[model samples]
Target: MTLLQDPANKNRYKVNLVPAANGLNVRTQIPFYSPWRVFFFADNAADLAETMLLYNLNEPCKIENTEWIKPVNYVGIWWEMHLGISTWAMTERHGATTENMKAYIDFAANHGIDAVLAEGWNKGWENWGEKDAFSFTEAYPDFKLKELAEYADEKGVMIIGHHETGGDIELYERQLDSAFALYQSLGIHHVKTGYAGPTPDGEHKHGQFMVNHYNLVMQKAAEYEISLDVHEPVMFSGLCRTYPNLMTGEGVRGMEWNAWSEGNMPSHTCIIPFTRGMAGPIDYTPGIFDIDLSAHKEDREKWNSEDRGNTAVHATLANQLALMVVLYSPMQMAADLIENYEGHEAFSFIENMPATWDESIYLDAEIGEYIVVARRSGTTWYVAAITNEEKRDIAFIANFLNEGKTYIARMLYDSPESHYENNPEDYQILETEAQQLDGFNLKLAPGGGAIIVFEPD
Candidate 1:
């Protein structure tokens, strides 16, 4: 018998979804305008339960045709600081060359990455305080813009255009036409724009100014059929459902500033699940394989007189991996350098990570103390459980799996023998055949974590 399952809400209205050729044919008796939230995941997993809880409001909003809606499956590969594609490159460690740029693009293609966020490749902020930044339509003389876009398109890689303004609203508005024209010429479908500056009139731009601008761009992009990934903007307000093209927005601090500043710690990421992030989807780009906390310490010491505290916690890397499941972003970014993942086994999880989930669950979490998140893409389930600076041993019941099916679970975590100096090969991988009755115990170190990938045998 063909099996079908609908969202189970024993006490209230439920959405009945029938499997269709493309997706789920959804049907719900609830009113169309009923205040509701629909969580999207790539598959079925334990995490889906949590997602339903976090977004499920008091109102009655029913699913119309589940079969019509499919999970989003696009992973965003951020190629700005990591890959030297534009002059706005932050680290200056990498160079901007066609070969180097293509390497990252190829990395994405090889690793099953679906989308590429070419940040800092647009016009503006080329010279931190020196000259104008490079434009997409214009060639860099070293690399041809059109060629790069064509190459990416040919390789089945969707290029996500980026626009970062250092708080220059006038510049953005004035050059809006040219900006759109540039992306259009290059066949870019999605754009990730950001504004980093002092709030106008002493109010946060992300609150009002940036939010208004975000909607404006969304409106304009809708006319052009372009998608949006806003950064340093307003918190999510269920705009994805309304403007399906507005994939995600980044308001919280992400991994980038973490490398230089001390903003994003395990505690900070943990706090987001219930605070600022509670409102909507956060492009709080996760996934940092390399926790080189000692990096730039000399510079920090010589240039400034503050302790450049080490951030490469034993568990933070695992926490990042777990974030792939915890956070809901259509344009998700694995915010780490490619070389950091080279030859590492855990990188497999990062490579296979899906942009959206078919179902997601917040799991157990206590704001800033710790969090457990699970997400499903298909029949397979990916779980990421993480704690803050404090370490703890936890267990997750595998009741979300198919009851009778034998499933294999692969695990990765920080090894007891590994430290900051010898952390490269500290990961241990284990496999176990489990049923719904099995519960997995994970011993995570201080600032450490555990990652599990489950598949039916």
Candidate 2:
């Protein structure tokens, strides 16, 4: 769906449907009606962030039993491949071996993380970008799916099943039921579906064909009481509120881009809460302790030909930490390697952070510049703020705190020397006491961010 500006009228804009091989072909009965062209209005960015108009517009929950649908805070073996330390294909340096997944599962069980996602556990990753190259129900020899699932269950952690279709919709559709049934038999409740390559029939990723395909998969997943985190998916249209099992999706340029290309700018995340965030929850995959690729530099050069040796995350360490609160995803990922997080002081924040929230408040925002948000879970409140490339001082009153109640605020923010390019890892943690109406001031470095967790004192 392309937004085109009017050539004749300077102030007018229109939505255009780009034609693909399938074109805009839809045959319906005589009484058919087109979908709604929604337009939302708000007095300010904060008002826009809090609006539930989209959820209201969507249908009510269709499933009778909603208790099975729950939020997932997961760790994964995904980042290593993106960082060039490992390969997705079944090579000597493959990332998704049984031993590696078991280690991740053990880490999740110990760290309060809910599940573990193993992306390359299945076969056909070697033939990525080719049609009909992947089998949803098959696994590589190195990855023993049944054994890993049993180990994860014993550790009290769940395995997030992966089904990368290589954009072969027909192949996925044929094996969809059998694949879901396999996962169900293994007691796996969540799956992350990927469509990394072009559709075989040349349908646009956002075209009607893919849209209907996604809907069909979601409906089938619901039948088996499974949740999904979809990547390369259609823009969310508030169907999550209805299906609920459509937990979160990746419709934005996520953290993986930092590993491969010139990373997302500081302003990119600042703009998301008001734009892409309005659609629904996002799988932005936050919490990277290693701001620069220092640990993997040598290994990356040895293993990955695609590594240009220049790509690194363009945000302060605090900026990555703050994203857990600023960006919402029910299936949130601590998207760094386990070794990067082990024995790290900053890891405490992610270890204790909650993926599901009871309430969220937009404190302040200026689109593409900066944003501040506060979310509450049970009695604790977590506030996160992020800035663009320019350093600035942000001050706000904590009137949202419970009246007359003393609380402890644990703040993690960029240090005075912190810069995204020069010293992205420089940050400081502070603890202070606060109450209702207390004024707080924060100095954010260029391409930096801050996170504050408030607990009852």
Candidate 3:
């Protein structure tokens, strides 16, 4: 029997490594995110997970009849805040304006992005820290909701509504129907909802009460045909299977942390797939072109001050690119400013990659160390490999590829000089030809990754 099935040692293994220190900020414990993540080789793993999600997963399952929502590859108006350049309100610090949003819409028109997310478009952001501070239906004067939707619709782009409740669940529920109505009237079907703080004092995030709260929101939201992309959310527990409208949620340490905090360790990404990912799709919001923060160093320091650690991505450009495939999100974001990406060669991979996969295989995985995933969409296959703080060598055969068909392998990889802390931006791009029988070797740098796209030759 394998370690997971061998009923020999329960108390010996603590099930999780992240201590209470990691979760004090979120007002929850990390032990709950572990426990049932050790098994994956079995043929009925998903069925086993479904049984667990209903019982020990600690999340309430309120299944309803709803059609599956298609995945979207999107962009947003969020980089300015992460860079510490602007705030969300309408003051001089405000970053999202009509002209700027239109520029984003124009950019989305040409690129493959499906939606443009506008946070702080509503009026209540000034009181974002105050409980019950936001009005769900009201828009800031500068952000013309009517005209903005028209502009996006004309450009063949969709607008993703934003609702930052700031932990006021009561107030959010009060306005839910009307707010969703407003979005529906404007042709907006997807929205990002956030609860940045803990539920009223003395309450925790994953408690049964709060779990039901999330389910109520998803159930109510489905009536208006709106899909929810949640931030500052409870850990995933496979709720998407029952409510397909609950598309993706940001429940882990993500790219934004790299801007303000000590930043997520490279191993954090490798560790999460085995832990929290047992739940569902994560809106980790990957894809940042400026791995080297030189262009925005001043802004980052101004905004973060002493809290900012390295203020740089711990991975090469190719590593960031590989995350698009490795981090599975039906709703993925090209999370960088448009201008920075105009001339970059790696942007094409993000552009061409499909939002959903037909089949996926975990070529290899080791908790907190490294993982490799190969996904197929239509006739092409995409492979991504990533490692933690340590660099490692990897070699795999293409036996998964179809036999007798030659394929062009477009690869984006880390350079020899690439090191997460030393030189995060170093990378090289190449195209090659290979067959099902051929094997390839990859050297993942410290905090680095590799991506390969195979198209029939």
Candidate 4:
């Protein structure tokens, strides 16, 4: 009459005795409760993070014959709808017309963004309640698709297609091949698929069937050499190891929530890297210069009430910029309207950061409180740190740098006059020389963040 128990309190491994219906006591066991965690006794925070990635990841899963697998730093037409600046339909406020798209293409090309995403380029966006409301191949009258495609090709920018099917998987599956063929012919190798609203497959979005459905879409996308970024997706659990082209996902409370609904708490990003982010990379769409939410007053009043009532993203402008590094999305989006980014020096950070990284180090982290990360793209290293609603001050030892090497640290962070609730936009820039033996200190405002880049001199 013995029951198996955990041998030690600190170890995560556990087991229990199981009795069969026939009263047989078997030596069956349970796995570790903390399956995703691996503790390491390393030299520093950077060492711990690098080791963690190595512990969990398999080989890079690039598909065969997929030539020119490009990185996905993108600019897109998503934030306008949330901000009430534009609608997807063919109306006065519509933002995805040919003229407007061409302007965005120019902006992206000038800023080093690799792809452009237009949400309502196709017809049937206004009729979601009806069956087959998404037509991926047919364009609206004002959205000159072929011309825009040619322009993007000439500019050396890829055009990312959008397909929001209102959860009508049947119709989406039926149109899948033709839609993919259209994109392939036009030289587009990526698509952002959305499954908003309920699933018609009589299953919850996370149900086995829906997960299988999402997998089927990725498998098919690979056939056409098209990578996928799915919204309203199943939680990522090493799916990238199986499908290398499965880039970013929108499964958690994202930046747009601040526009229309009660925005995500400041702790959201700090928490996700261990929760939702542990499953896969997230397309959180982080760039927004207008924290006040007063830009579209009439729309805010008419739709969500002028009270605004804690609808802000609850972070400083620097925090938004820092998210590009802390949130590890290969398919990253500078998701704000192009005009909002004008003349902003912080925009330069977004422009300079690359979509892929050769190595990453989770420098310091506390779940739902704060996090610090460092990553190397090429010869340069970028560091980003973010805090929760509470104010925090952090200290970093530059021992992560190579020994005896001198580097310049370029920082963008909240100023002394800034607070996420009181003065969200105030930021200061600093440039200084540092070495691996030196130390750095950071002061974070309530719901604030910081970005530091180290380049060898």
Writing each residue's lDDT as its tens digit, candidate 1 over 123-228 gives 3334443223334344444545677788888887776777766666655666777777877777776777876664443344433345566778776776555777
- How many residue pairs clash in all the candidates, one count each? 32, 0, 0, 1
Deviating ranges (above 4 Å) for candidate 4: 1-62, 298-310
What TM-score does prediction 1 earn? 0.76
Compared with the true structure, what per-residue lDDT tens digits does model 2 show for residues 1-457?
5567999997788987655565565545788877656777888887788888887888899999988888989999899988878888999899999889989998999898999999888888888777678888889998999999899999999899998888888999999999999999999989999988777566787667778899999999999989999998888889998999999999899999888877899999988877788889999998887888887678873344545668888899999999988999999999999999998999999999997999999898888888889999999999999999999788888888999899999999999999988999999999999998999998999999999999999
Which ten-residue region of model 2 has the weakest summed lDDT?
Answer: 300-309
Error of 1 at 125 (Å): 2.3
lDDT of 1 at 368: 73
After superposing candidate 3 on the true structure, give the runs of residues whose Cα lies further than 4 Å from its correct spot: 1-68, 299-301, 304-306
lDDT tens string, model 3, 369-441? 8888889999899999989999999788888899999999999888999898878888888999989988989
Q: lDDT (0-100) at residue 409 of candidate 1? A: 88
Give TM-scores for every candidate, taking all chains together and pairing residue i with residue i.
0.76, 0.97, 0.86, 0.87
Please name the candidate that would achieve the greatest lDDT relative to the true structure: 2
Model 3 score (lDDT): 0.79
For each candidate, what is the lDDT? 0.61, 0.89, 0.79, 0.80
